[model samples]
Target: MVPLLKRFTVFNLAQCEGLDRLAPEPAPLPERQIIPAAEALIDATGADFRIGGERAFYAPGPDFIQVPPQPAFREQINYYRTCFHELAHWTGHRARLDRDLSGWRGGPAYAREELVAEMGSAFVCAAKGVVPTVRHADYLGSWLDVLREDNRAIFRAASQASKAADFLLAFEGAPEGQPAAARQSHSSVQERIAA
Candidate 1:
């Protein structure tokens, strides 16, 4: 058995050996390339996107997404990240994945849905070759409460998130000159997601 506490030496990286041998971080993709890709994914969903608003949200009733203009974001990637998060919610529409979204804001059900969306966004971002970050750090406390109360909550959320990501990614690479909606049936994707 290992001791609960163990003494260890700590040293600054500047004084470490072979520090100069480390490789430089790869350059991030330009917004021009990344933004269009994200927009294309959004287009594939065929969901009405309304740009120009102080907040970003997906309206299940109207089956539409609304987000602030790109200029409102400090980084362009952040704008797409927000869009992806909202898109995850969009996938839960009754006609789509049919996830329960009746929870009021800040309620337990809402928090659970938020957790799924956050992970879904991260999955989509990773699939699109972008590193994902927590879109809503403010939800940490509620998320912890959710995980603590239910041992299997994380697993369920992760499974749901993977489904959401696959649903969105299925729209990618539609045949040339073919409408995205026509390229793949929503039912088929939903069945796969459910599986």
Candidate 2:
């Protein structure tokens, strides 16, 4: 059986900062490699995405991943990765992993989750037969700056990545272990986070 945590394992390999807190355990979540049911996850989550359109839309739920729209397939993939990243963030919702996206929307909390999801999406893309972005130089400056400010931000990212992975895994009828962090009871990650 494919372990659901590999989604997180891939995030860790991408250097997700915060999950370090959970490292002492032996199983050590799965890595960036494809788990047994990657396709199942794609289907179960109803994660089908459109190729071209406007940048943003109003969705009633906070589980939507917002991507900047464009024409290039490359841009499409970038946004696709970003959308997965946001979906990764939304996975932490109270009904699911219950991550606090609301409190940290535009702040460091939000950025940290973005980083985790960014890495997680890259990992998932690779496993699902797409290429991971190599233009991380574009992200390093801001990411490092954020990391410098929040000592524990990495930990939060790790937890969020695991939560995202759990969310993906749940789609496959996989087991979900409670993430290391306690989720906020009320509010969506979006309502708590950004515009």
Candidate 3:
């Protein structure tokens, strides 16, 4: 048995910002509709994606991405984030963009590649109307180390990320109400942003 507190704890509700009232939950999309949109987006890139029990990864040998089953993520969005990250790596496969994917972990090359993948993921998320969040905040130190080592490192990574995003989104066809010239100009603006 445990002793009970003599007084009840209290919080000053007025001081609590944004919690005065409960916000309504978003209307949930059907699972079948949700999964296929992302799946089709991935499939459109011509890369094989599979569900696995292990940690997610992009296997270069067979050019496929292995993601843990949907249940592995706390939220549906997280699974897609992981998928986009791995798919960014998939863009580096020899038959694709051909990046130097042979780097060992903890090496400078590995750090650079990780930077590319992360930025690429962010770009893809933004394109797909998903707000980007830092999925691997722990890797910030490694990324900072890489950036400190090379002045142009971030530029190159951003350019590659933009290209990876463009490559993936291209399969979705044109954006509604946007003309081809506008799209091309937007890409040019993105390239300027890299500079």
Please estimate how well model 2 matches the true structure, expressed as its whole-model Cα lDDT: 0.51
The best candidate by TM-score is: 1
Candidate 3's displacement at residue 175, Å, is: 15
lDDT of each residue in 12-113, candidate 2, tens digit only:
344766666765656532333333344355445543344345553213154444444433324344544555555565565566556566646466666675
Spell out the clash pairs found in candidate 3.
none
For candidate 3, write residues 14-130 as lDDT tens digits: 667798466566665445225556655765565577887668888878788899876655566767778888988987876556788898366777878888888888777766766
Question: Model 2: what TM-score?
Answer: 0.52
Per-residue lDDT of 172 in model 2: 47
Task: Please provide, for model 1 over 113-165, each residue's C-alpha lDDT reduced to its tens digit, 9 standing for 90 to 100.
Answer: 88888888888887776653444445544585866778788778888888888
1 against 2, candidate with superior TM-score: 1
lDDT of 2 at 114: 62
- Alpha-carbon error at 157 in model 1, in Å? 0.8
Report the Cα lDDT for residue 158, model 2. 60
